[model samples]
Target: MSKTWFITGASKGFGREWAEAALERGDNVAGTARNLDDVQELVDSHPDTFLPLQLDVTDRSADIDAVRKAHEKFGVLDVVVNNAGFGHFGMVEELTEDEVRAQLETNFFGALWVTQAALPIMREQGSGHIIQVSSIGGISAFPTVGAYHASKWALEGLSQSLSQEVAGFGIHVTLIEPGGYSTDWSGPSAKRSDEIDAYSAVREEAAKRPSANDPGKPEATRSAILKVVDAENPPLRIFFGKAPLGIAERDYESRLQTWREWQPVSEEAHGS
Candidate 1:
């Protein structure tokens, strides 16, 4: 039984890789990109197995329509990959209100809208997989990518709760926490905040870090995703790079240390 997939941001980056991986494996795919022409080559090459949809994931109505159309075309959606999101680079103080809203709207709320649209269909089918492309920052924060981290953190929380809620329906959720890869994420797709003199040191350091031009490959992440989709019981959280694991462990360890130190004071607020 060939699976059907709905992948957001299919025009490029990890989304494009995921779509190719699925099609190569003989699965049907409906991919959403803001510009249909961005994926015309894919549509032309895989006419029988690929459907390219024009979508802006932040638009709730468009998301619902896209999911419904995919379901109608494929009969069922075995996997729905929410991979449409851009990175916002800035310190908390440097970002404008609009920038903050845009980050949350696309990265957090956009995934929320698409997932909400897919839930009922998957529930009725009694089985499905929802893959959220969260970042390593979802578990730990860095200096300049604060806004991006905030968005992914919210997504992680949403997917965490969603997994528990949908487990009975056999709709498993996997959060793809990968470190920086060679993707447009830190390049053209990434938005930058205006200069603020006080944060210059931190911003300069961030700029020195590798971007999408790094040696790492997005294809590797795509391969990891395929492995998760094929597994009978996929982990709720799967990591792509050792960097993400290192960040998570360090963050958790530090938090635990603080928690232990505060135990007596923290327990005072709870009922005996």
Candidate 2:
């Protein structure tokens, strides 16, 4: 069966790769970008199966309209990928009100709006998949990118709750928590806060992290995404690269240790 996909941020990175993979497999895709010209190639290449849409996911109404357009064109939306977000690099203190708001508006609220818009359609069909493109930052916190971490972490929690809520409706929600990938996410597409002298050392240390130097190839994720969307029962969350597993293991172990250490205090606090 040919599936129809509505992918945001389809102009580049994982979204573009996944869109291409689906279209190549004879599936229909309504791929969106802020500038339709950025994704026009998909339309040119897969004329019959591709629909390019210009969208700013942060706009709630725009997201709803885009979803409606996709359903109108394809008649069904088997997959919806919320990949329209960018990274904001800065320490928590270095982040400004505007920067933090912008990050959440797009990374968190944008995905929320899209999910809200797609739910009714999916519930009507009684079958659909929602893929939220999160990051390793969604699970673990690191310095210098606190704002970015906050946004992804919000998504992680939102999707976790969404999975349970939509299960009865036959809708699946998966958060794609990818490790660092060689995408423009950290380049031209990223927003950087003003450098602070006090945070210089922290920035230097962050730059030395393995993820900063070693990033997975975005193209390598194509097969994994295809498998995930095709699975009869997909994972609620899946990491796209090798690095995330180890990082998650270490982070989880530390978190468990801290929770165990504080278990006595937690139980005591609950008492009358």
Candidate 3:
């Protein structure tokens, strides 16, 4: 069966790759970018199967309208990928109010609005897959990108709850927690806060981390995404690259150890 996909940030990175892969496999795709020109080639290459939409996902109205337009064109939205977000780089103290809000507006709220817009349609159809393009940072935090971490972490919690809420309706929610990818996420597309002198050493330390330079190829993820969306029972959360498993294993072990160490205190606090 040919599926229909509505993908945000379809201009580049994983969005573009996934959109192209889907269209190539004869699925219908309504792909959105802030500028239609960015996705013009998709339309040119797959005229019958591609609909390019101009969208800024941060705007709630825009998100709703884009979803409506996609459903109107495709008749069904089998997969909805919220892939429009940029990385913000800074220490917590170096982040400005505007930067923090902007990060949340696009990374967290944008996905939320799109999910809200798509839910009614999916509920009506009684089936759909919602893919939230989160990051390894969503699970494990680092020093310099605190604001970015906050946004993805918020998304992680939101999607976990959403998975439970929408399961009865035959809708599936999956968080795509990708490790570092060779995308422009940390290049031109990244937003950076003003650096503070105190955090310079912290930034240097972050740069030396083992995963800092080892990014998976963006093209390598297309097959994984296709498999995920097509699965009879998709995972609630899946990692797109090699690095996230190790990170999760190490982080969760530490977290579990801490909780166990503090279990008595936690139980004591609950007592009368």
For model 1, state the Cα shift of residue 262 in Å.
1.8
lDDT of 1 by residue, 1-272 (tens): 78999999999998999999999889999999999999999998899999989999999999999999999998998999999999998888988999999999999999999999999999999999999999888888879888898999999999999999999998999999888786778789999998789988887787665433344687876678888999999998888864667667889999999999999988997959
lDDT of 2 by residue, 1-272 (tens): 99999999999998899999999999999998998888888888999999998899899999999999999999998999999999999888888999999999999999999999999999999999999999989999888888888899999999999999999999999999999899999899999999889988888888888986788999999899999999999999999888999999999999999999999999999996
Instruction: Report the number of the highest-lDDT candidate.
Output: 3
For candidate 2, give the lDDT of residue 153: 91
Taken over the whole model, the C-alpha lDDT of each candidate is: 0.90, 0.93, 0.94
Sequence-dependent TM-score of model 2: 0.98
- What does each candidate score in C-alpha RMSD? 1.7, 0.9, 0.8
Give candidate 3 regions above 4 Å deviation. none
- Residue pairs with colliding backbones in model 1 are none
lDDT of 3 by residue, 186-209 (tens): 899999988899878888988887
Candidate no. 1 TM-score: 0.95
lDDT of 1: 0.90
Where in model 2 is the C-alpha error above 4 Å?
none
Question: In model 3, where is the ten-residue run with the lowest total lDDT?
Answer: 206-215
